[model samples]
Target chain A: MDTEEIYREMANSIVSLDQEKAVHLANQALDESMDLLQVIEKGFGEGIRKVGDLWDEGEFFLPELMSGAQIMEKAVDIITPGLQSSGSERQSSGKVLLATIEGDIHSIGKTIVATMLKANGFQVVDLGTDVKAEKIVDEAIKGDIDIIGVSTLLTTTMVNQKKVIDLLNQKNIRNKFKVIFGGAPVTQGWVDECGADGYAENAVESVKLVKELIQ
Target chain B: MLFTNWLEDKSKIILFDGAMGTQLMNRDLEPGKIPDLLNIENPEVVKKVLASYYDAGSDMVQTCTFSSNVVSLNRHNISNLYQKINVEAINNIKAILPSEENLIVGDIGPSGEFRPPVGNASGDMWKAGFQKQAKILAPGIDLWHIETISDLQEMSAAIQGIKEVSEKPIIASMTYRKTKTRGFFTIMGDSVETCVTKLEEEKVDVIGTNCTLGSDQMIELIKELVNLTDIPISAKPNAGQPRLSGGNTLYDQPVEDYVNDIGQMIDLGVKIVGGCCGTTPTHIRKIRTLIDSR
Candidate 1:
């Protein structure tokens, strides 16, 4: 197949969540001496971007986004070594620390955000769920992170999102990192109340919000 | 026990309790710890919370075991406390009730892991996790109540697992978000009609929406559900949509407003009415008064 056809197949494989086809295309591209970064950017990248768009439009749900993410991650895993060996520039937008705030165990929202951020060239350190504010702040400072994203599904746990910011201020280093919050219960009012830098309603907006915050 | 049997009759509306996590937070629950773990470590605390709900005239009180499933417990690295937590949670609720007639729902929440081909967790894993919790809590519980489930696939797996351990009636509820185009659908994309149809097909004793939308929005969703099935419908809406005020997440619906909204639910043939997030005992008390007045 021509390069354009191969890229189209790769993108289609991700959109369809056909992991085997995605991997086979990645391997075929490599064997044909296709540029690995081009495969990642145009193939896996375009596919996931479309998946994100579908998700934004509510045409896709968590299962489809997650499946698509896994497929992209798989293809990226196969291509990363080649890009590294060829000394291609694999620039990251920034590092983000993501977690579901303390007292909340819901992780799907945060996981989706993590997946999307990773796909968009952001380094994400996921702290799972029910994470304490102090721990989140400590990691932000220690890891030199650019952004901290807190997620909480429970109304009660939403306070902990602010607690992370409070801890950062108490440490007198609040200006060091941008803080973003999201979840079912979160609103723009909560973002302001918590003194968070930004808020995203969903995974797609999360990437955009992070980009805006960093810029 | 009389009320427990009557719940199956579906001749009258049943009143389930309001939010447990918020009530516990009021009782000084440390934020990061698993609330279910409180059952094993502080049964008195768990018992006190259950007692308040029962005192508020909740005919049925759910155990403090919402997140006790293996997947969630393991996430906190406390999987070994799973059986103890579920067993103690029921025991604590049982200890508080004045009579065995008062139903104790073995509450189950989502496993916090998406089932494949979306995530790594398989259907077998979802079934196993829920089954493990069900078996442990089966001895003291009168029925199973799965609440705040967003995914239909996960809900199906949970019900299947719970059925393997007990023949008790299961009340399966999904949390839904209102979409402009679809009307009302779960975050996982199960619409009100779709979810009700699926839950009915699964033969769950009760089916409805809970957690995300408030009673106002829920009344409309419940109306849609009531149209789809003859099965008794339940509505456990949040007090209202959440708002941020002074760093606190506050639900805008007051007890009167909530009770008022729920009155419409009752009018529309909803058989089971309760509160989800942001609801308090006062809300439950008001609901009781409404039921009594009716």
Candidate 2:
């Protein structure tokens, strides 16, 4: 198959959740000396964006979206180093530190945001779920992150999102990094109340919000 | 007699307890630690929460085993205490029940592992984790309450697991989101119609939505469900939409407002009603009063 057909097939494999086919196509692209950036943008990136669109339209569900993300992650892992070594221009967006605040174990929403942000060129440092405010602040300081995104799925844990901001303020570094809050229980009102810089209801909007913040 | 039989004999709606994790947190259960651990290490704290529900006129109280499955427990590095966590949670709730008539539900929640082609967890893993907890808690509990589930596949796997261990009736509930399109659907995109059809197929004794939406949204969802299923429908909405205030997530619905919504749920023929996140004994007491008046 030509490069275009191979890219199309790779995109189809991700949407179909065909992990093997996605991997095979990714490898085929690599072996055929396809432009690594073209493969990423046209194949894996296009595939995940389609999945996101389906999710937005309610035609695809969490499982399908997650599987597509997994496939994209795998293909990207295979292509990223090759692209870098080939001297392709690396698009560096702002760095983001993400976590599900302490007391909450809900990671799916935060994970989706991380995937979407990565797809949109943001460098995300995910601290995983049940992350403490102190740890989030410490990571932000250490990583020189531009944004700290905290999520909570439980009402009981929503306070922790604020606590992270509080800790940042206590350290006198709150102004240095923008903070975004999200999850099922979080609202725009909560984002303002928690002193977060922004809020996104879903992953797609999250990427947009991050872009706007950085810009 | 079975709990389902007893439920049928009662003419009134059954009231389940609300918000165990939040109640426990209020009682000083530390953040980020497993709440189920309290069942084994601090039965008094667990008992206190259950006792409050019982005092609030809850006909049934769920054990603090919502996250006791091996998959969830393993995340907390306490998978070794999985059996003890579930069994003790049931035992603590059973201890606090005023009588045998008061039910102790074996609470099973999401496994925290997504089943493949999305995540690494297999169907067998989900089933085994649920079955392990069910097997341990089934003896002490009156029935199984699988709740806060978002995925249909996981919900089906849980039902199959519970059925494998016991003939007890299962109350299966999924947490749904009100889509931008104004349609009721689970986080995984399972519509109310889809959930009702599938839950009925799985032979769940009761089916409904829980956790995500508040009682107002739940009333609308229950209306949709009432049209589809002949089985008992439960509605365990949050106290209200959560709003952050002074760094705390507060559910703003007044007790009266919550009970009023429950009244609407009852008017629409919802047989089982209770609270999910942000609900307290106050909410349950109000609901009890509403149900009693009816």
Model 2 clashing residue pairs (backbone): none
Candidate 1 lDDT, A1-215, residue by residue in tens: 78888889999999998999999988887777788878888888899989988877777877788888878988888888877888885677899999988887778788889988998788999999888998999888888899999998766677778998888888898899999999877888888877889899889889889989988
Model 2 lDDT at residue B217:
81
List the candidate 1 regions with Cα displacement exceeding 4 Å: A1-9, A28-39, A81-87, A100-107, A127-144, A153-157, A170-173, B1-11, B99-101, B244-249
Per-residue lDDT tens digits for candidate 1, residues B1-294, read 454466566567799999888777667777556678888888888888788889999989999998899987887788898978887787788788867557888899988776666457777898899999999888888888898888888899999999988998888988888765657777777777778778888999888678878788887787788788888878899888778686455677668989999999999888888898889889999999999998
Question: Which docking band does candidate 2 fall into?
Answer: medium
Report the Cα interface RMSD of each model, rounded to 1 decimal.
Answer: 2.5, 2.6
| A27-66 per-residue lDDT for model 2 (tens digits) | 8877878887778788877888788777777777777777
TM-score of each: 0.88, 0.88
